[model samples]
Target: MQVQPLDIVVVGGGAFGAASALELAERGHHVTVLDRTASPHPDASSTDISKMIRMDYGADVFYHELAEASLDVWEAWNADWPRALYHPEGFLVLSAREAEPGSFEFESERVLRERGYDPQHFDAEHLRSVWPVWNADRYPEGYVSPRGGWAESGAVVARLLKLGRGAGAGFVAGSFASLLEDGSRVSGVRYVAEDKSVRTLKADRVIVATGAWTPVLLPWLSDVLKPVAQPVVHYGVDDASRWQSPVFPPFAADMAGSGWYGFPALDDGRIKLGHHADGCVVDPEHRGTVSEDHLDLARVFLAESLPELADAPVVGTRVCLYSDSFDGDLWIGEDPERSGLIVAAGGSGHGFKFTPMIGKLVADTIERRENPWLHRFAWRSLAEPRQEAARMQH
Candidate 1:
């Protein structure tokens, strides 16, 4: 229904893309969102039932602050829409009692304290008292955050897509072919629609939020962004009451060691669980099917660490793809080789929580707005590998 050249063309309709389209459209830019699948449809990161979000990432101060801001945004939007987009069940970081004071959990507690945010540290007995259903003996200590939880990504993506559509942004189901380039500047995108017809949409600016598909579209940046496949599983709580849940926070297994993680019981009678670190390197198109072994790996960790819900039966499984940058941080800025093209991907695994601010940053970059955080995450800055980034202390 739009006639003139669009102000921005966004490739990929996942959370980042939808959020980008929503923000740009809200800014009065005629926007077009192109995706092979429908918005919030399967295969997109945003549609996966839930994505764990919290402010206890340990050492990543920028991400920690951004997460806090994002929580406020999610809460406000949930209230405004009167919808359950975010399930604010809070989060827990589990670790050993004497596991060095400088570890990520310890540093996170320090950071939270400095910011006037209290993260309660509990011992085995305290953990038992707090969560009787969980096995306190598995870990000596745990840090509980009253202000973190999981977001129903699919629902949020659906809401944003709807809002964007209502705001005059066009959503077309198609496969993004390539960037329409005039030398170094990107003009628009060519896509094959659902009916197999190829159409070209022209725009002044292009934002690529293809998630795991970022490197494929921009082959030149293959070394910068590596799409990784992360498998997540959901287990049904056989006896919900058997676990003295205590509003079981979104938990991360041994913040020092990348292992188990899970959510509180949802209204749908399923709890989400996954690994915070380990995942297979897989391609977006030819990814492996979620299998029983994947589910077992998640279950085994939860059982050993948090014995309360270990015996739960597997309910469902999903694969989460992370566009990992060389430094394991996010890449959100203009491409070095292309003008008028803003590349925003490289989630690694923890990008979902900051979708709102990321959308704002991508919009700002497209509009040439000055922002400190956006500047820090630019393409040029990411040229150097962040080895310390992998050992996040926030």
Candidate 2:
């Protein structure tokens, strides 16, 4: 059989890769997106039930800017379709005595302020007075951003996948085996389709947005991308009305202490809980179960920090993967060692909030274009290193 040449071949159907395909396809590129499974399918980060979409980047100037820009894009899309892609419920964070006021958590507030955003601060006394459901006596302070909120991650991915199809981008269900290369230049991608047929498609450019499975596809960058497992559990409370407090924002309890974060109750009466920046290192293909100890930690956090939901039942629990970088930043751009291959992986746990902007970033990088945020997250930079938990403050 004769091989057909394409303009670009993207090796992941996740949000980043699908966004890249849509952006380029709209620009008239013959794009083909190859993925291990059809999009909107489970097992991919982009299809998770929920994802945070907010502008509080916590002192990362580059991400702050991207978040701001992504908000505009999300708004534009919402105006076009009127779906629940971005919900502006605001974010509420309670800090403890152990945390400093102007640390990472505080710095994020500062960034938002510098960008002309309005975020309210509440001392422990004020927090308890405003929200009787919370036991703010345990915390020193709380921060509330009326602008921060949640987004339906899986729905957004599904919508984009549908848009990509309407835009003429081909979606092939397959697992990326490896890249077909000629010397240092990437020529195409080798993958096995859902039918178990091995096929190779040639392209002018190849983008690897495989998320946690990125290292498995390109073993040469094993040291750069490490997959970590984090515990995530969903709870159902008896009275969802307790979450209807006016001051309640998608909140974090230990941002002042242990870095725990969670969302407000969804319309479905479930509130999610998980800690940030503290996941166990594991392989993407072989993730393990969430240990009993981990569940105990979450239970204790909810019980000790949130009195209203302390007795809530653990309705659901699952393990999520975080593609971590040493410095907790993402790896985005063309690979240094290979030509025609661009990477946009290792988002740590913060990539979701920047989906629209990250899509633009990946699209721009793949086209050899200039993007402002690229200066902070270069394709090949060794200076910015990832250090293990220095402080648990969110």
Candidate 3:
């Protein structure tokens, strides 16, 4: 089935939009990426110092497989890009108690083994010997997957935008206002340009990949999509070498129970930590600062888990917003009611790791291609909200 190249307007130039633009343009479609800023918007979730790039999805084999596929591309990108942004140091999953059935750490290791990957299981003694920073008593058992690590998120987005442009995708700086509709079909988008002038972009298809702003821009999705703000903080350590790789790697500290996870120190000696539990619902336009309660919680967790970092100076704090879906699965596909409107949102806080694969997944959706992974992200009716397996239930 031969299809004609369509003129597509992708709203929001975050990971989803930028990647989709690159893939779509490469496939010969006319793509124009409209974003709030030039590239890597400061407030966008995709614009971060570092994000975990792991294939540990607990018992969810679907995401595990998707992440496995993405990891291959991530490695390829490292080879193709001018400089490597993804650092495959490894990921350590820790548990306070011994690994048991149904636990996130247990399931993740079990799944990895089932999929033919060797994860090194360790007891507290082994962990203490390898990563001395951890409180051995607090984390008695866990495993480390040598294949997982972290990516410089903002840099990855910038690279994607550059590649997309080279592939013939155009970029427009503007704030999305509304969809321009012709009858029941979305024919274009109306946005406020950077110069304060109102403008319109006509397209054969419109992809709304605006992240947390999805429900706000498209009110009909409010029931299913929500904007959630999670707290993230960076601590400055005196000796960064002690916190870096081979000694310390990206880690989840009893994450399923405590919602605490952190990365090894950056070159400048700052360690990043975030909570992956239920966040407060917020309006993207008026998202407030990280709550004092959240900060207090982080302090307590550090005091118990990593005493060395408990008193470290706070370098930065942010309220990271996530576009949460009723179910944690991503939303990607055409609208059932609107003919030309497609949505590529619902990152739900774990989308950045799959950056390498999202574009092709979205492109397949747009072209109505038969992709095995497409069904997991397709638009559907709302249901009881279920967090992704790796996320903590608070």
Candidate 4:
């Protein structure tokens, strides 16, 4: 079976676009990636200091399997890249109550054990002895899995773009205006160039990987895809050593219940914390500042979970926008109504960790290749929004 290489254009240069461009170009396609800004767009969700890398999806075995596969590639990237971007220190899944059935902590541990991985269970006493920074009494049941950790997300995106360019994918800076169509088939893209001039790039196929802006670009999908904004805050710590790995790894503090999670301190002593709950709908162009209510909630959570960080000076803050679908699962398949058009979006806040696998997934979808995971992400009718298992209920 001889497949012809076609000219392809990918919109967005974040994790999905960069990964897709790299994969498509490597597969012999003439690929071009267009973005409003350069790679690692400052406002893009993928442009963050750190993102958790864990296979703990509670009872969702599908995501757990995908994450496990992604982790193997993350390790391989760490070994092959110019510098290590992924830190495999470990991940602590802390629960405020006992590991009861149907709980995120319990299901994650049970699934890990069932798959032959030994996640170390911990109690109040163990937390006090091993990770003294945590309020032992607040987190009574938890587990630490050595298989997961965090990654420098922005750096990873940059690396992927660089790799994509090196693999013969063209990079262009422009703001996408609309999909150019020849009748019912998408022919290419019309964009506003850096100099404010209109430009058009023709392609045999077009992949729109524009994260939170997906719904905005394709208004027809507005009902199924939305832009939701989540808050992320960074606090400066006086003692970085106490908050670094081997002491305090990346962790979820009753995440499914409280939506609170944080990473270990960076070299400059900044600890990044974020909430993964039901965020308010937002316009991608006008993503507002983090609300006072969210900061107040963070303060309260810290006061009870990590007392030392309760009043730590706020170093930075940002509203990370997610391309949320009706269901939390990603959308990556050709548009049924439009020939030569494919979409790859719906990050939903948990997509960065799967960067390594996203490219292959997008490539598979583009080629109509037989992949086991493609069916789950294909375009379909909207249903009741069933978010990921680890997402918190507000």
Query: By summed lDDT, which 10 consecutive residues of candidate 3 come out lowest?
Result: 385-394
Put down candidate 4 lDDT per residue, 272-330, tens digits, no spaces. 99998788899988999988888899999889889988899889999999888778888
- State residue 297's C-alpha deviation in candidate 2, in Å: 1.0
- Flag clash pairs in model 2: 58-108, 326-386, 327-386
Stretches of model 4 off by over 4 angstroms after superposition = 383-394
List model 1 lDDT by residue over 324-344, tens digit each: 777767789887788988888
| Model 3 lDDT per residue over 169-258, tens place | 999999999999999999999999999999999999999999999999999999888999988999999889989998889999988788
Q: Which ranking of candidates, highest lDDT first?
A: 4, 3, 1, 2
Poorest lDDT segment (10 consecutive residues) of candidate 4 = 385-394
- Worst window of 10 by summed lDDT in candidate 1: 385-394
Clashing pairs for model 1 are 58-393, 58-394, 59-393, 59-394, 60-394, 90-148
C-alpha lDDT values of all predictions: 0.76, 0.75, 0.89, 0.90
Tell me the lDDT of model 4 at 315: 93
lDDT score of model 3? 0.89
Q: lDDT at 238 for candidate 1?
A: 55
